[model samples]
Target: MESKIKHLEMVENIIERMAKNCFTLKGWGITLIAGIFALSAKSTEQKYVLVAYIPILVFWFLDSYYLQIERKYKILYKNISAKSESEIDFDMDTNNIIITESVAKKLCYFRCLFSVTEWLFYCPTLVAITILIRILNVF
Candidate 1:
């Protein structure tokens, strides 16, 4: 039982680490794309501004996927932590917990992209991208 608890804690830590990395990568992607556009805006083709959206969107959706995975593992952690020693096992799988939330089980990157929390984070960048694309001729 003690070993099972320790193993679950270890799994939670791993998931937390990955989740932090996902957010870090997303922030870096935004920074890099913005930097590329800034550096090349004057000398490069104006249309290149539109290309920034590609990575931005990709990173945004990818971050959501990571968040989904993190949420699942968090759920599993809670479930395991709540159980009696007799109920806990070494199997530590998250799929069974996710099944109860069929909608969550079916969630894909594209769908997660539009999740309210994700939209709150990424939509403003998308708005900025659209405005930048519209004004590319001015740059």
Candidate 2:
């Protein structure tokens, strides 16, 4: 009983840490974009958009990876917590969860990039980039 609670706590801590990493990646992405805009605003070069997008895309992919990991841990957490007392064990390994080869291949990080939660953060920035590009063309 107590051991089950402890295992659950460990799972939760891992989830919380991964969640923090996802948020941190997002914050850095936003900051990098803002820095690019500020630099672009000061210069006549139209290449800054390219410069800006590279990092944004990289960070977006990395952030999605963390989000996917967090989600997996949450699933593990649920499995741990939902177990009956008699069925509970200290096994916290999520890798043991069987994933079919097809399902595993389909759940790539690229797919996660388009997930609704990720879009909520990145879509606005994409729109802003387009606006900036159009504005550059005008001048």
Query: Tens digit of lDDT per residue, candidate 1, span 62-104?
Result: 7887877777777777777777888766565767763455656
Mind sharing the TM-score for model 2?
0.81
Hey, what RMSD does candidate 1 come out at?
Answer: 2.7
Give the best candidate by lDDT: 2
> Candidate 1: where are CA atoms >4 Å away?
102-111
By TM-score, the best candidate is 2
Give the TM-score of each candidate: 0.79, 0.81
Model 2 weakest lDDT span, ten residues long: 97-106
Across 1-139, the per-residue lDDT of candidate 2 in tens digits comes to 8878888899889989988998888888889888887887788885776577777778888888887777677767777777877877777676864455765554566767788878888888777777887887734
